[model samples]
Target: MKNSKEWYKLDAFAKTYSSIISEGRTTCFRLSVLLSEEIDTDLLKKTALFLEQKYPFYNSELKKGIFWNYLQHKRNGFSVELENTYPCTDVKRENPLKIIYFRKKISLEIAHFLTDGIGASDFFIDLIEKYLEMKYFKREVNEREVGNNEETNNLKYKYEMEKSSKNEKISEYSDLYSKYMKRVNKEKTVKHAFHIPLKILEKGQYYVTTGEISIEDIKRESRKYNTTVGKYLLAVYFKILLDKYPQIKKQIVIGVPVDLRKIFSEKTYRNFFINITPSIDPSLGSYTLEEIIKYVNNYFKIKITKKEFYKSIYKAINPMRNIFIKSVPYLIKRIFFPFIFDYYGERGYTTGVSNLGILKLNRKYSKYIKGFRFLPPPSKRCKIKMGIISDESKVYLSFGNLTANHEIEKEYFTYLRRRGIKSKISTNY
Candidate 1:
């Protein structure tokens, strides 16, 4: 109800998204959690409202400034929707973020401007926690508070207590991408990678195919190669692509997003990860899975270093920090930025795979939760975007596709199945 919120510019990672967002190319992602039973819609609605106060950035809207763009906050109310369409569709600028609940799941479909997968999960987890607290734990405490005139106070106390646990740095709105940015020598450019030429799905359609497999299985397989699970998976991914396009000469580049928070003591949730392109150049000749893994791991080892990583991060942070780029009026920047982004950004990679790592839920709330899934947003050039999240037992691999074909996803899982990693596939076809 108040406009006391301060003004801020869009984070560096959001510049491309902001420009292309208007062309109906809003880069978006979905974080979903399943519950033990059907969701209590009424209570989930209240939980969404409460979580908003805790994460006010979700309510932000983009406004064009003369030189750049400004993100203005408006405490506009949002209503949860029933899950009907495929997950991770393009969210319009007007309603850049939304919460939709299915029977046993609540999915947050948010624009890239909102936050990264990790940031989204923070809010999604809180929403689930608050809802469960109200449904079970708070009810457990309700009998105590009902005996006095402190009912309202008790509720507010719970709100404040939970809210207080969160680090206040979340509200600071500092651009972590820019904050940790280091100037580097000539920023290297990415050449065009092998693009999946699958038939595009109908305009209103998006395909999400999930493969649920045991984390232990993945670990066992990965260790056999002396590589981590992510690198191992990329090896298999490259192998699959190489097999499918045996004759293609281009590199099979996948955008593997790195969490800068690991090195930089940053807390802003706006958007702060950089994609490291780990690729397989088919021209190098045929290679086995182990060879592919070795190649992928080598790329990863080199990229993680401070010098190598900043070179990549500098490319993204430079535009936002560049005086010329910032001074070129939003109108002109918007016109050329999208073209540059699609050509330079997404064009650099064939597809993207982001691993959000394992999620360990609180014991108190574990019974109320089922599992979690991460769906990465697809790009114009990259037909399929993938995400991986693991709970204690299983790893969930979701492919958000724009194509009618399931060949790539099917083959990826098929490779895992051959390795004795059984995968139960599900899709929103």
Candidate 2:
């Protein structure tokens, strides 16, 4: 196959995010696979090289242009390397994405500009499938299931862009803008939510702690609460926060990223998700777990409707559509956008929780795979974030923290244990 020298423009979401990224502060997401055995560096390298040929988009490098940043196909071949530092600390023009393997773990760290978790997971699954085949069977996996060429590879992007651009309704846009304005007008100026007090670590340093619990037990608890797993978990997160910081009597808002692939029919490996922040105000009164679950369930029901979801998307994209905003020079937009994001964007939400849903693998490859963990990007304001991934039997809750405190994590596991769920903890310090 010949390499095409084609450049793809960043989508609206990516375009907005690319401007705000700085050194040590990035919009990178990590999807890691923990193998049952030690990694074969040579074989893993060969696997990455082969997969890069199949998905050339992963091989693209970021470039700064007159109007916006774009991705151009990398002329030189791609290679996998050993991981040296924490996740997503060095995403820039030199290397926007990377594949790193350390001992039993193989991680794919991609800049958020490239794709969302759904898209990245698709690519990672194919890479793992191909790797297993090459390692054990010594054969090439069939491409018919995935696609033939690069164009077919990015079909999701093509479909989503086409659909998003075509369905422009002025009324819908106005309604979304109105809602955003109403929220901002009455938005309370609250201090950053209390985090477990600990000595701050050096820049780019992160502490990762993971807890494994039985999926069956999680389901049982969720059923008892009459809510979905995601909501139940969010309730638990809020409960722990309240326990740790009882003195603060303000609302605690947690950002939950909803995957748009299910709602929108697009299958693109690019980003297509929106964040919804569900909040609980302790000033109202002490909230029982039942009340928190009820609030979370109602929030999800209202916000996840197609009309509401589309409104949120339009709200996000509406700024880019303005003629005046679009007319601003790139340099000014670069400086102004990050400030807007820092003050209005990051401050609104206390923390973020992303549930990647369950991972399905063929039985043959399942034995070689132990499980999966997701590491969220580091944030200065929101010091701790939670990422959830599950296999058939066990659910993995990973906490990616910028602070050195273990108090919050300790309370979380203890709460779970009190509910008759035992947890096994592991950490990368």
Candidate 3:
């Protein structure tokens, strides 16, 4: 173990936010793939050794009670433990990677902070394919993407300006509203135990007429409905819910995570992002898909302007208890977060839909890979959570937190397939 050194300031902020909000148990996403070969235990060790050697940052620990501090400079990194814990420092004496290669299912759970929806897609796809090749092809394969260099110079604003915008104040969360905050504070946050099963997802080459769809296509379609692609997708999902859960009348709000980089010019490799801008909750018996699209599109178009972007950033960064909580220690932040949540209402959204838009990667895996799909973290709020991620060729629709909703997932794939597009659904369902 090493003594704590000062971490980048932004990293500290990210650590603060995540520690406060992350419940630990449901924060990670579990991915299951069926394997064809017998367990390659030695090769699994080799792969872990290869990763550690290739990316030294994977061995580092969090300091100042902040995970982001450990990751600020390392854009791509992960720490392997014999087990999981916050501020994990110990290194694995044995190979952390495991393989079942059973007739059933193989699986892996990924920490959300390690990668976003887009990044996870590449990693998962690459990992599966690499494992396959190692067993069958007997050849080493590299699927890592390169050159995610910061482009602050090309942006219009400075990081400080963005920081200032992020520091603005917003209306506080009412204690009456943030009831879950207390449970979160005193609750024993469950850290999920490791489980990589042998479930498999079938793969195939998919092509679409809209594979060549450019920004112009997105913009044109958006205008056709007077909405962004995000709003359009929200409308589609909302319709699916209506079709499935016709009896439920609660507000159907979809959480949309807005990337601050779209507005700010900060290039720091930390999670300085916020999930704001919910779609208009469709009325119980009244709203049609087109109507929901209109309402959501108009609302997003109005709310996500430069002014709203900065305002939302400010609300997330500038703590309501800043002056008072300032006297509170960093360690206390993790313990007493429910007090804050009780005030803030746990980010007023029901389901999450993050659009990393299109995934961009280097020449690696270009020839072998067809596309990508983003599966959102399973929600305690909703039974079925959906996300869409695309490459140049196809739109991959994925659902998470769904224990056995393959029928519903199949319906979505069928809907897209009927639209004259190439599609596939991947899940244990």
Instruction: Write one digit per residue (lDDT tens) for candidate 3, span 94-212.
Output: 21122222333334444444433433444545555655556666875333311122242212123323442354222110111111111121111112211112232221111111122
Candidate 2 residue-wise lDDT, 1-429, digit = tens: 334555667767787778888754588878899998888887776677666655656677877777677777776656578999888776766576788899999998888888777778888887788788778778754454234455654564344334434552321111222223221222233335443445557877878999988999988999998887777888999988876666776568888889876875445556778888788776676778888898888988877866677656665766777788877777888888887777767777788898988877777898899889887777766778898988899999999888888788888989989998888899988
Sorting all predicted structures by TM-score, with the top scorer first, yields 1, 2, 3
Candidates arranged by lDDT, highest first:
1, 2, 3
Q: Where does candidate 1 have its weakest 10-residue lDDT segment? A: 140-149
Between prediction 2 and prediction 3, which has the larger lDDT?
2
| Better model by TM-score: candidate 2 vs candidate 3 | 2
Residue 55, candidate 3: C-alpha displacement in angstroms: 6.9
What are the C-alpha RMSDs, in order, of all predicted structures?
4.3, 5.3, 12.0
Better of 1 and 2 by lDDT: 1
Candidate 1 accuracy as lDDT: 0.76
Which residue pairs in model 2 clash with each other? 156-268
Best by lDDT: 1
TM for every model, in the order presented, reads 0.90, 0.86, 0.58
